[model samples]
Target: MKLMVSFSRKKVSEPIIARAVMDTGVLINVERARIEPTEGDVLIDVPDESARTVCMKMRELGATVSVLRDAIIRDEDECVDCGACISVCPQEAFSFDSDWKLSLDQPRCVLCGRCIQACPHGALSLQK
Candidate 1:
């Protein structure tokens, strides 16, 4: 499961994520992180089995967590595989497979909307 975790500037310096990882035994992969002096937002992936515990722990530490399952949807028919999304994706979520077919690593997506905006064919969209 993927999650978008928000933290206030006051909480940004906390070792909340480390504690959650240690407590829940969940492998947390940070997809994207934007932490400023005033606020922070992080996109992370957690194992399904440990999502509940991790989220609970995050909330207890005063972070806001939102599940991001299937956050980005791609329309194959509309996509020409032009690779527009590839260059702009900070998380490297878009890629070309062995066959040069455009592929998306959904879990790595931060729902940043860059892919959607870069797609000339309007092939990508946020799931809501």
Candidate 2:
């Protein structure tokens, strides 16, 4: 599952994430992270079994966490399989099958909206 964690400036520098990783024994894949003086945001992929523990630990450390479900969606009917999104996806979420059909690895998607914008047929969208 994917989690979006927001940190206040006061708690931004804490090693809470490291602790969570060590405690949960799960490899948390950080897809995106942005830190500034006032606030920070991190998008992470957590194992299903450790999601609850990790989220609780994050909240205890004063970071707000939200679960992101279906962050990206594709309309099969609308998609022309032009490979436009494939070229722009930073995560390589979009790919071609053996038959050259477009496929999407939803879990690898970071919801960056690059695929949505790259789709000339307007077949992709980011779900809120």
Candidate 3:
């Protein structure tokens, strides 16, 4: 399960995420993060079975937590299998199949937005 955890100014210095990890014993894989002193957010993936527990624990620790169904959206109609997205994806989420067609592994995306920017046809976008 994927989760977006947001930290406010007061929670910035707190070891909230670490505490949640320790309390729930959930293994969190951080996929993306932009953290500074005042505020920040972290995109993480935890075991599906433990996602709920980790969400509750993170909320209890003063984090704004929300489940994420997808990090990116691809419009098949507009994409032309040009491979531009594949070239810039840091997570290697986009690929070309044996038929020379583009494919996407949505879960592998880390919300980097590189694929969207690289697409000439505006077929890819960050999930809003």
Cα-based TM-score, every candidate: 0.71, 0.80, 0.92
Candidate 3 C-alpha lDDT tens digits along 1-128:
88999988785456777778888888888889998878888999999999989988888778899888766888989989999988798888888999999988877877888888889999987777
Kindly list the per-residue Cα lDDT of model 1 for residues 1-128, writing each as its tens digit.
88889999675457767877887778898878887778888888888888898889899888999998779999889998889899999889889999889999887777788888989999999986
Model 2 clash number: 0
Best by TM-score: 3
Q: What is the lDDT of residue 75 in candidate 3?
A: 90
- The digit string of per-residue lDDT tens for model 2 on 1-128 reads 99999988786566667877887777898889887778888899988888998899889888999998878888899997889988798889889999889999988888788878878999988786
Worst ten-residue run, lDDT, model 3?
11-20
For model 1 the local lDDT of residue 55 reads 89
Q: Against the unseen true structure, what C-alpha lDDT does each candidate score?
A: 0.86, 0.86, 0.85
**TM value for model 1:** 0.71
Model 1 residue 124 CA deviation (Å) reads 2.0
Model 3, runs deviating above 4 Å: 11-13
Q: Taking the candidates one at a time, how many backbone clashes does each contain?
A: 0, 0, 0
